[model samples]
Target: MREGAVRWLSPAGFFTMRWWEWGPEDGAPVVCVHGLTRSGRDFDALARHLAGAGRRVICPDLPGRGASDWLPDPMLYQPAVYIAALSHLLARLDGPVDWVGTSLGGICGMGIAAMAGHPIRRMVLNDVGAFVPKKAMARIRDYLGTEPVFRDIPALEAHLRAVHAPFGALSDAEWRHLAETSARPAEGGIALHYDPAIAAPIRAAEAQALDMQGLWEKVRIPVLLIRGAESDLLLPETAAAMAAEPHVTLAEVAGAGHAPALMDAAQIALVAEFLAQ
Candidate 1:
C-alpha cells in the first residue's frame, strides 16, 4: 500500500475532501473514482494493475467516504460538489489525465471529461453509463436511505458482502479486504466508512429522474464502457448505444450484477489495452 497527504478542498466550507495516490509520484497519471458508498480504496486492484504498466493512479475519497471529512449537510454531497473537488485535484496534476471510474464515480468522471477542453484524455466507465435503469436506481435508494449500523468487523463484513452481492463471486479474503477498507470506528464498534447521509442526493436525483444527456453527448475523449453482464445498473442496450459513439468502446464482465470488481487478469488486461491504444 502507498500513502500521501489527505488534502482537503472546500467544496462545502464546512467539510473537507480527501484523496490518495498510488504508483510513482511522477509516473503517467490516471485518476480513479469509486462507487456510491465506496471510497478511493476501491480502486486498489485496478490501480496496482495500471501502476504495473507504469501509470500513476490517483483515487479520491469523494466527500463523504473513506478518510474524507463528512459534510454537515447531506444536500451538498451531489456531483456539483464532487466536480468542484475534482477540479482542484486536476489543477494539482497540472496536465491531462486518464480516468477509471466505477458506478457513481464513473458518472462524475463522465461529467468532468465532457467539459470543454477538459484534462481527461481517456476514460473507463465501470458498470455505469449515460442511462441507469429506474429499477436499479430505486434499489440503490432503498439500500442507501436505510442507515444500518454494525456491532463488529465480522458483522460489517457480512453486511458488506450482502449489500455488494451484485459484484458476484469473490473470495473470503477479498470480501474481508473490502470490509476493512469500507469500515470506520463508530461509537460502540464499527460502521461504514462513508457518511450515511450521502444517500440524500441520490434519492433526490432518482425522484427527479435527472437527465445527463448533455454531458454524455459532449464527451470528446476516448471512452470505454465496461458493463457487468448481469448488471441491473448499466443496461445492455445503453452500453450498445454508448459504444456507437465514434470514440467509445464497450466490454462486458460476465456473471456480475450491478458492478464488476475488475480484479481478474482478463478485465485488467482489457483496461490496459484500452489505455495503451
Candidate 2:
C-alpha cells in the first residue's frame, strides 16, 4: 500500500487528510470511507481485494480518527466539516470516482452525491440509510463521548468485540486487528484513537429525527445500499423505500446488526461487484 495526504480546509483551518492508496495509480479509482469513530485502516482487507482486481482504492482517515489531525474547535466535528474536507480530497482525485461509505461516511457520501456537480459516479452506502432512529443515534452518542482506556490490547479488543458486535461475525484475528489499529497511547494506558471531544456536537445537539430522504432523491447515480439485517439505524421500511427509488439496490447481510465488517470475502464481494458494474 502507498501512503498519501491531501490538505483540506475547514472552518478551523486546513487539516491534512491521510489516505492509503493501493493498485495501479492509473486504474479506475474507488474511494472507501469508514464509519463514525473508525479509521481509514478499517478498509485494509477490502482495499487489498479491490486492488488485486486492478482498481485504485483510496481509503481516507476522516479528521479526528486514525492518523488525521484533531479539530481545534471540537464543535467543528460535525458532518458539514467532514463533507467539506472530503470534497477537497475528492477534488484532488480523478473525476467521477466510485464511493463506498459506512455509517457516518455514508451520510457524507450521500450529501455529496446529491449535489448537481458531484464527482462521485456511483455509491455504496453500508448499514446506513436516509434516516437514523433516535434510539440508535442516542446509543452512538452515549458511547462516543467516553474515553475508555484499556490496560492492554486484549482488554481493548474485548471492549471492541462487545461494542462492535453488530459488525457481525468477525474472526478472532479480525478483532485483534481492529484493536491494534484503533488503540493509541493514553495517559495511563491505551485507548481508542479518536478524540473523545469529537462527540461534543452529538452530546450538545437537540434530540430530533434525522431525515435525508430529500437528499437521497437527488442522487441519480447508481447506488448499492447494504443494510445489516438487524440494523437499528436502517429500518426495514426505509430500506424498502430506498430500494424502490430509481437506480438503488438493497442487499441485507444476515447475522449483522448495525453494520457489516466488509473485511470478509462475501461482504467485500458485494461492494466489488457493484462498483465493477
Candidate 3:
C-alpha cells in the first residue's frame, strides 16, 4: 500500500504522477498499469500475489487518475503524452522492468517496449492487442460517458457494477473495493476518482483507427497476452493475428467480457506465472 510520486514533463507542462509499490524494493521490478480512466489501485489484489512471491511490483496511477494530477489540457490525454510521462518514470527506475498492462495500459506498453533499448524486459497485455477498431471504441465510450456524483458509496458501487459489467464477475466485496478505491469526495457527494474530461479524447477518437503493427513488430521480448473469452474489444481475429506473431502467447480467460478483473486467483495466477518465467 506504499505510494510514491514522480515529477514528469509532458509537452503541455510538468505534472506529478503517483505510483504504488509492494514487496521488497530491491527485487526485480514489475510495473502494472490499468485501463482508461482506471487507477493503479486496480492492481492491489494482483500486486499482493506478485509481491508475496518476492517481486518488486509497482502500479502507476497515470495522470488524471487516482492521486495523480489531472492534465489541464484534456486533449493531452492521448497515448503519446502518457508514454512520455511513463518513459520518465522508467528512466528514474534506471533498469529493465517487466510490464503488465490492461487495455490502454497495454497500448502504452506496446509503444514503449517497441523502442530500440527501452527498459521493459517482458510484457503482458490484458484484453488488448495491436489493433483496436472503431466499434470497440464506441462501446468503451458508452461506459466512459457516465460520470455521475453519487449520494453514497452504495449507489456509486451499483453504478460501477452496471457500467463495468465487462470487467467480468467481480465478487460483491471486490465490487465494493472497486467503488471505494475509485471514488473522490465531491462538493455534494462522491464521484468516480478520475477526471471526467478524461473521456473527452476517447469520444473524439471514436472514428480513429488504432493500429500498432509497427510497434508490435519491434517488440522483441517475450509477451503474454490475456484476453477475455467474451471480449468485444479484442476480437477473435485480432487475438489470432497477435498470437500468430513472434514473441507472443495468448491465454483466454473464460466467463469474462471486455476485460478480466484479475482479482480472482485464477486470473492472478495467469499473470503471476507469466511474469515468474
**For this target, which candidate reaches the highest lDDT against the unseen true structure?**
2
- Per-residue accuracy of model 3 over 85-113 as CA lDDT, tens digit each: 89988988899899999999999999998
lDDT of 2: 0.91
lDDT of 3: 0.89
Clash pairs of candidate 3?
A: none
- How would you encode candidate 2's per-residue C-alpha lDDT over 48-132 as one tens digit per residue? 9999999999999999988888899999998889999899888898487999999999999999998888889889999898988
TM-score of 1: 0.94
- The backbone clash count of each candidate, in order, is 1, 0, 0
Looking at model 3, residue 170 earns an lDDT score of 88
Cα RMSD to native, each candidate? Answer: 1.7, 0.9, 1.2
Compare the candidates by TM-score and give the number of the best one: 2
TM-score for every candidate vs. truth? Answer: 0.94, 0.98, 0.97
**Structural RMSD, model 3:** 1.2
By TM-score: ranked, best first: 2, 3, 1
